[model samples]
Target: MEEQRAPGQWWRYGPPWSRYGPPWRGGPDEAEPQHGNRRPWRSTALLTAFVLIGSNFAAHDQPHRVPLDPYARVLLLITSLLLLWRHRYPVPVAFGTATLTLGYLAAGYPYGPVFLVVAVACYSAVVAGHRRAAWASMGLLWTGHALVALWLYRWLPPAGDTRAGLTQEIVIATWVLAIVALSELARVRREQWARERADRAQAARRRADEERLRIARELHDVLAHSISVINVQAGMGLALLDSDPEQARAALTTIKAASKEALGEVRQVLDTLRASGAAPRTPAPGLDRLPELVEQAAAAGLTVEVEGEQPPLPPGADLAAFRIVQEALTNVVRHSGSRHARVVFAHDGDALRLRIDDDGPATGADAGGSGNGLAGMRERAAALGGTIEAGPRPDGGFRVLAVLPSRLKEDQ
Candidate 1:
C-alpha cells in the first residue's frame, strides 16, 4: 500500500533546523508575522546605533577647549549612519563602515565604538550572502587594529603596565578577529544547510505528485475497460429480458464476469491508495499478454489482426505496448462506429512498435473528433519516452503507431 502523507507536509523529512523548508513564501500566516518580527528588530538596531552615538557625543562635549578633531567626529558620524542601512544592504554597508573605521584609526581616534560597528557589519554581511566580502572586511579590520596598536605605542607609549606591549595587543586583537571569523563561518554553514533542506523539500513534493499520477494511470487502465463492459452488459440484459431470454441470461453472466473483474482491480487500486502494507499484484497486462488482449477485443465484436514477428522487450516497453493496444482498442469500441479493427505489434532489434488501425469513418455525425482515448494513448507513449501518431488513415480509417525503445524502456 502507498504511504499515507498529509498534504504540504513533505518537508518534514528535511534537516530539523531548516527553517526555510516550510512553505513560507506568500503564505498568509507567515507573511504578517515575518513582517512584524523584522520591523521590531530594525527599530531596536536603530535605537542601539543612536544610543551609542549619543554616548560618544556626551564624552566629547568639552570640544572647544581641547580643540577636538572635527574630521575624526565626522568619520564617526558616517560610521553611525552606515549602521542604519546595514541590514538592507549589508555588503555595501560593511564597506562604507570599514572605510570610516580605517579613517578613524589613521586619525589616531579611539577604536571602541567604531570597532563595535565593524563587528555588527560582519554579522550582517554573513546573513546577506556576502561571505567573501565578510572575510575580506575582517582581514582589513584586523590590519586597521594592528595599525591602531602601532599608533598607540608611538603616541602614548606603554607605562608600567607590561600588558600594553606590541605582542599583547596583537594577540588580543587576533583573538577578537578569530571570534568574528568563526561566527561568519557558522552563519555560512547554516545558510547552506537551509538551502539544501529547501531543495529536498521541493523534491519530496515532486515525488508525491509523480506517485499520484502513476496511481491514476494504473487505476484508469485497470478498471476502465471492465466497468465499460459491465455498463454495456447491464443495459443489454435489461433490454433483451422478455423477448430473448437466453440472450438476456448471457448478458447477465457477462455483467457478473465484468463486475467481478472490476471489483478485483478496484481492490488493488484502493490497496495502493491506502497506507496499509500491501504488495502490488504481480505481472500486470503487458506485451506478452497482447494475444489475449486481441482475443478479448475480438470478443467485444472488433476484428483484430496480429502483425509482424514478435520481439523481446523490457518490462516497460512491453507494458506500454500493451496499454497502447488496449487504449486503442477501447477507442475503437467507443468511437470507431465500425466492427473491425486491426492490432499489430512488431519487434525490431532495438525498438518495439505497436500499430492499431480501424476501418471506421474518421468524420461524420457518429464520429466526433477522437476524444480522450487518443489523448490517453499519446500520454502513455510519451511517458515511456516513445512517440505516438494517431489520425485518419488515407483509406477511410483511424490508425495509431507507437515506437518504443526496447532497452531503455523501463529506465524512465
Candidate 2:
C-alpha cells in the first residue's frame, strides 16, 4: 500500500529541487536572509506578546496592576511597537522592553509579558550573530527582575519573601541564558554548512570544465597530425607527376598508403571516444611510436637523427614523450630552415629525459600557428609531473628538452 503524505506537509517540490523547478521558489536548504525587514516568527512573537499584555488590563489583578488609564495604556502600546524591532536592533529592543516592564511592575501593572519579550529579544541577538549583545540583553533583563523582586519583598499586599523571589529570578535568568547560547550555536553551524556547500559546488564546476578541455585537446591531437600528413603527401605526389613518371607513381602510392593509414588512425581514435561506456581500448600512439614520427618528419623533407637509449615507460610518461617529440619535429618541419634535426632520449634512473634540436633560426622560430603544438607538449609533461623548456640554441638552431619523473605522478 502506498503511504500517504500529509496535505499540510506536502510541497510542490522537495529537497535538492531541480534548476528548472518553480522559477521563484527556492530550495528548502537555501540560507535565510540575514538582514531582513522582519522575520515572520519575530513578527508573530510581537503580536502574541501585545495581545497578552493588553488582555492583562481587564484581568483579575494581583499586586502588580498599573492602572489601565490612558497614560499606562499608551506606554504599553509603545512597548509593543518596540518589540516588533527586536530582530533588527536586538540590544536596544531588549533595553526598551525591559525598562517598560520594570516601570509597569513598580507602578503595580500586571506582569503578563515580561518573559515573552525578553526571550524573543535574546533569541534575536543570537540569530544576528551577536552573542555578546544577547548576554547584555539577558543581564539587563535579570537586573530588572531583581529590582522588581526587591520591590515586591519590601511592600505591597500579599508581600513576597525577598529570598524566594531572588532565587526564582536567578533561575529564570539562567534558562534565558541557556536558550540564547544554544540558539547562537545552531546559527553558527548553519553558516558553516552553507560555506562548505558553496565550496563543493565550485569545485565540481571546475572539474567539469577541466574534463571538457581534455576532450577537446584529445580531439585536436587525433585530427591535426593526420590532416597534416595527408596534405604533405598529396602535395609531394602532385609535384612529381609528368616530369618524373616513375617517381610520381611512387609518390602516388605513398599518398595512398598515408591516406589509408590516416583513415585507420582516425577511426581508432573515434572508436575509443565512443567506447566511454565500454572497457577502454589500448592507447593508439605513444613514445614507442617515435620512430614513425621521425620517419614522417623525414618524408616532410627534414632529416631526423634518433639518438640515446629509450627505455620501457609508464603510460603517462609515454604520452608525454610522444607529444614532446611530435611537437618538436612538427616545429622543425614547419619553421626550421635547416635540413638536419636530432632527437635524443635518455633514462636517468629516477627520470626520463628528452631533447630535440633542429638547425632552425638561432633567434628562434616564428611564434605563430595555433601555438598548441608546444603548449600541448608542455601540458602533457606537466600532467605527468614533469617539465619542459623550448628556446633557441647557442648554435644556429631551436631546441626542446623535457624531463618526465620515473614515478609519473601529478602534483594535483
RMSD to the true structure for each prediction, in A, is 11.0, 8.5
lDDT per residue for candidate 1 within 187-240, as digits (tens), equals: 878889999999999999998987776666666765656555555566767888
Q: Which residue pairs in model 2 clash with each other?
A: 64-109, 65-108, 66-108, 66-109
Model number with the top TM-score = 2
Off by over 4 Å in 2: 1-125, 128-140, 151-164, 230-279, 362-368, 407-412
Q: For model 2, how does the per-residue alpha-carbon lDDT over 271-323 read when each residue is reduced to its tens digit?
A: 76688766446565677788787677666667889998887777767766776
TM-score of every candidate:
0.60, 0.65
- Whole-model lDDT, candidate 2? 0.67
lDDT of candidate 1 at residue 384, scale 0 to 100: 71
Global lDDT of each candidate:
0.66, 0.67
Candidate 1, 217: how far from true, in Å? Answer: 0.9
